[model samples]
Target: FMNYVPDMQKNHFAKEPIMTPPSEVFVTQTIYADANGTFHFSLLKAGQWGFAALGIGEQKTYKGKALSQDAVIWVQATKLP
Candidate 1:
């Protein structure tokens, strides 16, 4: 995660970016980059998924037929071992 500065030497915010780990450590780690508005997981389940993110004042969910659909947040569950 990075910040955009109008006339600064580097692209770093005054405050460091906030990083939130997943609730359960055994499963996987969920990192959220607020500055970059992105997220990633340590592990991904290979199958169709229904995602929903709820925050203080935000709530969003998606139910796609397949994980490869053209959507904001869709995961293409590729066969893996």
Candidate 2:
């Protein structure tokens, strides 16, 4: 998990433009998936969370070039009433 930043710098990767701020990350925890390629997180704090699964896709190549597809998601959790 990481904190959200309002301002960010410009950076590019794989023909894609990215903007990320330089700030201290709150947490960097690694979780592994089971044989079915499924994972879960529990007891999470109420806030914004970011999840990324890098290069975990089945397709290893595309158009004769090595390709690694990544997945990312962002979620906002609120406290229970």
Task: Tell me the TM-score of each prediction against the true structure.
Answer: 0.30, 0.56
**Residue-by-residue lDDT tens digits, candidate 2, 1-81:** 344443345442234313343443434668798888688987356666788888887889999999989888888888999
lDDT of 1 at 56: 24
So what's the TM-score on candidate 1? Answer: 0.30
Question: What lDDT score is found at residue 51 in candidate 2?
Answer: 81
User: Which stretches in model 1 have alpha-carbon errors above 4 Å?
Assistant: 1-31, 56-72
RMSD in Å for candidate 2, one decimal?
7.4
Residue pairs clashing in model 1 are: none
Per-residue C-alpha lDDT of model 1 across residues 21-73, encoded as one tens digit per residue: 34456333344556545665533434433333335232233463223222234
